[model samples]
Target: MKPGTFLKSTALLDGTFFERSVIFIVEYNDKGAMGFVINNPFPRKLNELEEFKHIIPFPLYLGGPVDQEHLYFVHRRPDLIEGGTPVDAGILLGGDFKAAVKHIDEHTLTGNDIRIFIGYCGWDDGELDAEIAEGSWEVLEGGMLL
Candidate 1:
């Protein structure tokens, strides 16, 4: 992986999207990319929302164009769940869904501690690199380098 790649649990660089939008990448590989929009803050609250009601109070995100209904999250606190992989300093990605639900049920996790997102942005293999080469995307260090 490259530096400033956002890794797993790191927040998307600021000013990269709508105001205050923060994204967390969940899966990144040759197949494509996937993550959640953590900071978008839709008009609805968790209790008032359906679909992900099982994870009440967990903030929702605008992941991207891929699977808008799919759910994903990123957390820095690994002790709260199992199966998470370390992405970078102070960040952890991926985890057991049941563990996460238990944490939510027990009130051990909150929106600030973890972010939930629907949908995701993606690029087929070599597509991202091509975008960079074509100047459609810019690579920068430390935060959203548009």
Candidate 2:
């Protein structure tokens, strides 16, 4: 398993949720799969946006074709949070609108250290495994999922 890689759900096909979308899998296992969309970008910057201006400063990415109005984020700073699980050795993913705003207001966090996204990519049980066996997905190992 690589640190950053695109993992598409085999169960997601021809739906309003995930059509022709590529998701960067942040976590995966028997429990489930979690990821963010890489190709879709939200045209608004958080700092200038009315609702998120006080919360985040980063430009949001369209995490997936589903729920295009929700907010999600991935963070890498573990020192700020006590006992946060690492996505890798040094990377972590966690954020809420309130927490993000508080961190930003206090100048404790920066957009460079995190990424915001709208919606998310998900997979049900045994769905991704089938795709892996069918060779429809390619896994990569590196710093980021790009």
Using all chains and alpha carbons, the TM-scores for the candidates as numbered come to 0.67, 0.69
Q: After TM-score superposition, what is the CA distance of residue 51 in candidate 1 from its true location, in Å?
A: 5.1
Question: In terms of TM-score, which candidate is strongest?
Answer: 2
Once fitted onto the true fold, the runs of candidate 2 whose alpha carbons sit more than 4 angstroms away are 1-4, 7-22, 54-57, 81-85, 105-108
Among the numbered candidates, top lDDT falls to 2
lDDT of 2 by residue, 16-99 (tens): 455556667777777777778776778977677677566545667888755667776777665564444456645666645566
Kindly report which residue pairs in candidate 2 clash with one another.
Answer: none
lDDT of 2: 0.65
- Writing each residue's lDDT as its tens digit, candidate 1 over 28-144 gives 678765445444555555555664476556545566657766666667678877777766555566587667767876788875566655666666767756645664444434553
Model 1 CA deviation exceeding 4 Å by range? 1-4, 7-27, 37-39, 51-56, 144-146
